[model samples]
Target: MTTVAFIGLGAMGYRMAAHLPQHFDSVLVWNRNVDKAKQHAAEFNTQAVTLAEAAQADIIFSCLPTSHQVDEIIHQVDIKSGAIWIDCTSGVPDIARTQATYLKSKNVSFLDAPVSGQTIGAENATLTFMVGGDAEVFDKALPAMQALGKLIKHVGGSGAGFAVKAVNNMLLAVHLCAAAEGFTTLKAHGVNLNEALDCINASSGKSGVTENVLSQRIFNRSFPNTFALLLLAKDTGIALDLVRDAKLSAPVIALSQSLIQAASATSDADSDFSAAVKMYESWSKITLE
Candidate 1:
């Protein structure tokens, strides 16, 4: 019977950890908030343990907020020498690779497995995972990851997952901004919002933003907190760093990053990423809702 340890009990982490008990014989959970960890452990019929105890599991999964959090957890915990560490955080690629190297010195295998799809997707087990690490280690962890996502792909080695996640999120941000601008423009020209979405969905202009997020969430005025604007802005910064390091010219992505940064500065930081529409509305002096 394999034992797995899960760290972080936030939105995505909480849902992801719920599936572990179903797959593994024993599952240990740890969180900074002891009450939350205890609640989840009771709900899932799992064990609530300290970080050090959880670190002794064969596999240790971390779904933290940032690379700095991951570093702090690593330093505080006493993980078994040969335990596998899987990071689900959308962290910097270079930082992920450096952490992987450091963990290797202790005979611990590290993999970056940043996820896509928001909170609803996490609840539905429909998230897509982009993984980066050793082939053998990935194969071993595949079954565990399958419990949390519908699609999982090995992008490459070490930092590849972060690289792919950054690129994908950069494009998502750009598409969302463009969709918001287009939606606002069409409304200004006296077109119905729903009608404009119908035409766009049938045309080449349609994207994930239009087909999934905008059509479903934004139009409904639900604005449920799925992926926060601040997180998206942080991801954009990571993408910008990747682009700069590669000396690549990505004007649209750069622009989108700036727009998201501005959005994050507003109260929308705690709202959904779809709230980028709020930034456009503020600029055009028009309300989509």
Candidate 2:
């Protein structure tokens, strides 16, 4: 029987793990907070195991806040030989590569399979996974991955998934900041925010941020806690690291990162990532709506 274990029960991980029971023979869960693990097991009809028990599973999946937490868990657990570790964290690329090399010495296979599409996508099982690992290993894990995501691409070897995810989020930050500044300019001239967005969405300036995040989250002023601004800030920093490592000059991304980091520092931990636009609004003395 193929026994699978999922570690972490955060906003995204909790929903992502719920899909595993349908595809695997046995599903196990572990969390830093034991009660959350128990709660998930009760709701999903799965077993809640300790960290040690989780390590013994044939396949182990983790979706932590960062690669630092992943490193801590990997060192704490003694994973069985031939086990597969698939990490879904928005993590540092260098750390993912290090973890992969360390796991290989113990006869374990590792994959960095970071995801996009945010919390709603996690709940709906429609996330896009950018995976990095051996081709054969990706093929072997495809069925299990399919249970939790709609689009899964094996981007490259170890660490590449994290690299792709970081760059993707960097672009997202750029779009959001650019949109915020542009909208602030339009608002200065007393243009209807709704009409401006409609035009922007129809124009070359449109992005996922303008169409969805700006329209749904920022304009509404709801600022729901779907994904945290702090996490976005962290992801942007990771992207900056990758950019600098490649010796590329990315002034826009650097500026966006500073804006996101500043916003995250001031906003509550539960604030939605779109709240970064609030900085632009504050600077322009004009609200989005």
Q: Quick one: best lDDT, which candidate?
A: 2
TM-score of each: 0.97, 0.97
Candidate 2, residues 66-181, lDDT tens digits: the string is 99999999998899899999999999989989999999999999999999988889988999999998889899888888999999999999999999999999899999888888
lDDT value, candidate 2, whole model: 0.92
* Global local distance difference test of model 1: 0.88
Candidate that would win on TM-score: 2
lDDT of 1 by residue, 181-264 (tens): 888888888889887788889999989988988767788877788788888899999999999999999899899999989888
**Model 1 TM-score (2 dp):** 0.97
**Compared to the true structure, candidate 2 yields what TM-score?**
0.97
